[model samples]
Target: MITTRDATKNDIDTLFDLILGIAKFHNQEEYVLTNKEEMLNSGFNNEPKFGAIIADFNSKVAGYLSYTWNYSIWNGCEYMNLDDLFVWEEFRGQKVGLMLMEHAKNICKEKNISLIRWEVEKDNVKAIEFYNRLGAKITEKGIFRWHLNASN
Candidate 1:
């Protein structure tokens, strides 16, 4: 029996663990600078910077996802930007990812958001297939993209 629910303050440590797992999966572990305390403060605040959900399988924590809302000027509306969707290695084929996504979609619907968006690593074939199965279309990336850090 799998269940999904909004993440609470108590889940901060678990969330941090799951997030680190995801970062490692993507070879981005060094980028996980946010600590558990920071996650608890921002994630559970009255106005959360992002929304998080936990996936449980028979009372055991299986996985988690974090997302935020983004405004699209071309679409003239806000869309749910699924920042991260990850399932534990042991829970991969158990449909935990599907359950997490369905939970996100339901939340989006409730908020009157008709679209959900996210970018997948191009080499993640399994994820691309999964998103394709969910009717997500690929959009081409701009030829030039840049990020601003402390140093130029």
Candidate 2:
């Protein structure tokens, strides 16, 4: 059976491995790849700023999700930004993803978050379908990003 629970310090190494697998799967550029040490600092630091959940199946980690809360002026309430949702290749079709999402929903309810948000690559049809199946709608607006450089 698959079960989902919040990730703790003990799951850091396993979560790091899964993150690397996701980074490789997406073929992200080196500059954008997530580093294990940085993740540890951000998630397990004195004042951790992010939260994660792991999907455990028969005592093994099969998938995980990381999220943070964001405020929206338009909504006037806090919403959850699902930063990452990844499942192992072998567990793709097994409901590990669903279990992770359910976990997120529970957190949102507990935290009084108004909504959950995430971005998916345009070409990832499978992911789009999965999100839709989960009752997620694609906003018809574009997302803008600005990268800041230290040299400024």
Candidate 3:
């Protein structure tokens, strides 16, 4: 049986492991060890800008969905941005991802959030199809990200 719940401080180490697993699965292993402490602090500290919903199978955490809230000036409402949704390889086909999504939807419903948005790699056809199946539409608009640093 699979159960889902919001993550707490006690789950940090497990969450860290799951994040590394996802990075490895995505072939972005370099990111696996990046900012480990800060990331954990951000997600599990007293004031968190992000939140996570984790899936537990039997007694082990098998997946997680991490997200943050964004404000859309045009819509003038809070939009939930799903940063990452990952299920362990052994648990992939078990509807864990969908369960996390539904949980996020319920959160938005209660918070009066208007929309949920996420970006997927253009080459990830599998994910595109999955989102489409969930009635999520692809917009003609593109997202541009800029990192403000001393070099810039």
Candidate 4:
């Protein structure tokens, strides 16, 4: 069985591990800049920057889902940005990812969030199919980014 709970200060190490896992899975490990301290402060602080849920299977860590609240002028209420949803390889095909998504949906329902947004790597075909099965629309809008630094 899979169970989930809100990530706490004590889970920072595991959370960071999961983050690294996802990055490595995507072959983007170089972009994982934050560490456990940053994760703790960002998610467990008085004014949190993000929220995360940890998934466990049979008392072992299985996965995690992280999100942030964002506002849109187009929509009057707040929405959630699903930053990451990763299931450990050993736990894949066992519905851990589905449970994590269900948990996120319930959280949004409680918060009155009508939308949840996330970007997947273009080459992640399996994830694309999963999102499609969940009825998420794929928009043609392109995502752009800039890696900025103070020294730049």
Candidate 5:
């Protein structure tokens, strides 16, 4: 059976491993620079920058959903931005991802947040389908980013 709950400081190492698993799945492990210490500091600090929900299967860490709150100027309201949602390869197809998403939705509902946003790689057809099944729509806007310290 799978259960979901908010992540705590004790789960940082497992969270780091899952994060690397996500990077590996995306073939971008070489670009992952953050370490467990950094994750712990950023996630468990006095003022956390993000929040996470963990999916546990038989007392083992099986998956996680990390997110942050963002303000939409156009909407003039706060929304939840899902940063990452990942389930271990061994646990896929068991509705773990759906459970995580539902957990996120519950959090938003409790906080009176009406919108949730996330981005998935274009080629990840399975993930895209999953999101579509959850009633998410693909927007036409393209994401752009500028690296500030590429030399580092």
Candidate 6:
């Protein structure tokens, strides 16, 4: 059976491991530099920057969904940005991802959030199909980024 709950500070190590697992799956493990201490501080500090929902299978960590809030200037509305959604390889096809998404949707319902947004790699066809199955529309808009350094 799969269950999910809000992640706490004590789960930081496991969370970090799962994060690394996801990064490795995407072949971007080298890009992950955040340590457990940083994750703990950032997620559990006085002003938390993000929130996570952990999925467990038979009392073991199976997956997680991390999210943050953002506002749309043009729409004058707030939305939840799903930063990460990952399930362990062994846990695939078990509905764990669906459960996490439903959990997120419930959170949005309670918060009156009209939309949920997320980005998936263009090559991740499975992920795109999953999101499409959940009724998410793929926007034609392109994403552009400008990286900045703290020194600047």
Instruction: Output the lDDT of residue 88, model 1.
Output: 89
Q: Which residue runs does candidate 5 get wrong by more than 4 Å?
A: 150-152
lDDT tens digits by residue: candidate 1, 101-150: 99999999899999999888889999999999989998878545686799
- Report the C-alpha lDDT of model 3 over 92-112, residue by residue, as the tens digit: 778888888999999999998
Candidates 2 and 3 compared: the better one by TM-score is: 2
Q: What TM-score against the true fold does each predicted structure earn?
A: 0.93, 0.90, 0.89, 0.95, 0.94, 0.94
lDDT of 3: 0.85
Candidate 2, residues 1-120: lDDT per residue as tens digits? 998988888788888887777777898636455566777888887888899999988887899998887899998989999988999888898889999999999999998775999988
Error of 2 at 100 (Å): 0.2
TM-score-superior candidate, 2 or 5: 5
- Tell me the alpha-carbon RMSD of every candidate: 1.7, 1.7, 1.8, 1.2, 1.7, 1.3
- Runs off by more than 4 Å, candidate 1: 142-152
Q: What is the lDDT of residue 141 in candidate 6?
A: 70
Query: Which tens-of-lDDT digit does each residue in 1-152 have in candidate 4?
Result: 78999999998889999999999998899999898887777789899999999999999999999999999888887899999999999999898888899999999999878899998877889898999988998776787787788987
Task: List where candidate 3 sits over 4 angstroms from the true fold.
Answer: 32-36
What digit string (tens of lDDT, one per residue) describes model 6 on residues 52-93?
Answer: 999998898899999999999988999999999999999998
Worst 10 residues of 4 by lDDT: 138-147
Q: Count clashing pairs, candidate 2.
A: 0
